[model samples]
Target: MITVKAPGKLYIAGEYAVLEPGHPAIIVALDRFITVSVSEATLQGTINSRQYAETDFHWRRSGDQMIFDNRDNPYHYILEAIRVVETLALEMGRPLKIYDLDINSQLEDQGGRKYGLGSSAAVTVATVKALCQFYELPLSRMDFFKLAAIAHFNVQGNGSLGDIAASVFGGWIAYSTFDKDWLRTVLQTNTFGEILASEWPGLKIELLHVPNELELLIGWTGSPASTSRLVDKITIAKFAEHEQYQHFLAESQKCVQKMINGIRNHHLPIVKAEIRHNRQLIKDLGFFSGVTIETPALQELCRIAEDCGGAAKSSGAGGGDCGIVLTDHTVDQARLISAWNQQQITTLPLSVFQLTEASV
Candidate 1:
């Protein structure tokens, strides 16, 4: 069996604005991961996951496409990963082989509730990595990231794909999205290999170093938000309020850039200040966009963190899910966690998943 794992990601600073090309976001990979294991099979392949109730999903290859036995299968990301990676394999003169894929995830609770830790992106990355190993494809990190991004975009059709980068690189990263419009135009004339080798306009991913004295904390609101739904709403609102939306994007870029510099320079004060500024920017965005980016629970979560001497904000698309906090080591973490618990917020035990030389 060829086994591979990909880490979940949390957006630290940038949220809605990162959707635009060239806009920067600070994201970190969590220690929690989604694992994919692939083993050779005869004719048909099976995909099994306890998270999806232990039932085996069967599939077969027709030419270069993967056709599932069940039309209502819940393996959209997994199937897309297989399709794209197999396409690449066939292009490289390698025949596709049947394999049974086993998937396990740590990005959710015991009840299978997601923590909004980018589980979909992690699973897609893990599947791509597992299949690449199974096919003996020695792809570089950038190539792997591009492949996973393509698979994810085919399903999601929106967002920055910064989560894909975090899952692929596995560390604190400064990420900017590629031009989706350009990719869409190029796909008509280019193969996957050619696109992977070419330069993706406005795409950037750089690993960052965190300050030693800085402490990161995550609080879950026990509610999961659909990032795509929220983003769709924002997209509509953007057309109605184009000027305000542009201003929001500009401010978000500045705030994220400052936060990134703070992380690189080991300046906790600058990072904390930018976090607070970004929080207000998101709030203003929610007001104009007519979407509740931050729920009552998330507001309370951030309040408790601020009262305890930290900067806090909603993590992702932010209707409900997780909020991240950054504080110095001098703060009482136990008190912060206890305060969050009092308000029915669960403080998650997660750390940054750093990349090793071998993994990179």
Candidate 2:
């Protein structure tokens, strides 16, 4: 049996801009993860009968394309993973094999509430790893990231794939978005053969050095944030044309640089400053876009973290998802937790997920 686990991710900075070409985002792999176990099977495709069994899935081939049974199924990533890996095997002249896999995740609550950790990305990463291991394919972290990213992009048309990078490499990472236009064209126009013929383009990923003095904490607001809806609320603008939006991106770019440099150089102050700037910046975006970015609970979480001598802000889409907290050990974590509990926010237990030999 091949058992593989991949961690979910937290967005440190660079949310919207990362969607733009060549823009960067700082993302970290969380200790929370999805686990997949695969073994040889008599079936020709995937054999999953766990949490995913609750969802509908179909697997078959079309004229020239290998299509998922249910393209709109929420578990489409799982089918995409199997299809992509199978395409790789055929391209490399390796015999395709069947496998039975079990999927499990730790990113949600017992009541099925997602903590806003990147669960879909995590599952896709795990599926990629499990398939590679089952096939005895020795793919490097970057190679695995590309394959996993293809699967994710196949399901969700838009994403920076920073979560895939973090899930594969783990720890702190500064990631640049890939060429979305190229990938979209390929997926839209190509068949299974064409997809295998077009190898993945190299995407930039840098492992960031986190300061020893920095203490990271994750807290969940209990309400899920729909990132797509929030992005839809904003109007994309040219930097020179829309003055306010231009200023927003400019300020965000500066904060991104400061965050990358601060984390890399062990400069806590710069990182902290950028964190606060980003929180307020998102609020500003809310004001201009007329969409509420930070909910009352999220605001209270940030307020409590700031009052406790730490900096805190929403990690990703923000409407009411998880927030990242930065501080030193001197801050009373218990007090912060108590305050959050009072506001009904759940403090998440997490750390940077480091890769090891056996886990993959």
Candidate 3:
């Protein structure tokens, strides 16, 4: 049996702008994860994905004839992972040959898909790891990262690549977008990929599961947001020759730099300040409007977090999945949970994981 585990991720900075050529982003892999264990199939029948109860998936292969039984549009995530793996296998000159396989997935919770944690990225990483193991292919973490990025883009149409990078590297990473000159002239000329293949850098990070003290409350806006649309909107707004958005991006970058300091020095105050400031910059871009962040529940929750001596911000793509709440290490998790319950907001216990040499 091959057991593979992948970590979730959180975008610390450079959300929308990271799509640009010369921008950078930062993300941290969380302790939360999705694990896949694969073994040879004993019964030759059909492959079944029994992870999500709400979704039914079945695929059969009989002498080159294949059939896929699915309900929802299988392009979102898990299905995309399967497709990407199949494609990668073919690219490696190995046509996938599996009689049958069973996949069981565990989301953060059984009820709702939570935010702040990158579940999609975790699933993508796990899928890649499982495929690599099954094929007996030797691949570095960065290689898996590249595969996961392909899966992510297939699902979201466009991805920033930060989440996959964080999950694979498992530390705070400075994911700077290379300038055209850097990518074309420097990297291509110097063969940057070869350099990375030869040298590995060591970084320090801690992932903690403080379930009791560090409670997080997340709410949805009852509306789905397209990550690609948000990216396009930000790009147009930032490059439209508008001074206001230009200022916002500049300020956001500065705040992100402060966040980097916070991570390096373990300064909670700096992290909170930078995240709060950056949230405002995102808000100014009009992405937060008419979305979940504009919902009364989210606004009230933000106020509650602030009153309780903490801060909160929308997690991914901002149309709303979840939000991260910063609180004191001594804060009462039960109290926060109870408060959120009263307000009809669901709570999730956050985890902090420290990257190890072996794990990374």
- Please give the CA lDDT of all the candidate structures: 0.93, 0.79, 0.59
Q: RMSD for all candidates, in order, please.
A: 1.1, 3.2, 5.6
Which stretches of candidate 3 lie above 4 Å from their native place? 41-47, 51-95, 112-116, 171-174, 177-229, 232-242, 287-294, 329-337, 355-360
Model 1 ranges off by over 4 Å: 358-360
Point out the higher-scoring one by TM-score: 1 or 2. Answer: 1
Q: Which ten residues in a row have the lowest lDDT in candidate 1?
A: 63-72
lDDT of 2 by residue, 237-353 (tens): 333237777777778877888889888889998998888888888788777767787888888899999899898888887898888899897799999999989989888888888
Write candidate 3's Cα lDDT for 1-360 as tens digits: 676777877665567656644455666666777776666653243434545545544556564344565556442565566666665565566656554434454444554544546667787788777877787666776667656665676567555667777777775576744233232243334432343353222222223222233334444333345566766665566556468766666776677767776766677777777767766766666643222333455566666666666767665567655556767675555676667778777665545455676664
lDDT of 1 by residue, 31-131 (tens): 99999999999889899997997566888877766777665588999989998998889888898898899999999999999999999999999999999
Each model's backbone clash number? 0, 1, 8
Best by lDDT: 1
Number of the top TM-score candidate: 1
Among residues 3 or more apart in sequence or in different chains, the pairs in candidate 2 whose N, CA or C atoms overlap within 3 Å are 58-69
The order by descending TM-score is 1, 2, 3
Q: How many steric clashes does model 2 contain?
A: 1
Q: Rank the candidates by lDDT, best first.
A: 1, 2, 3
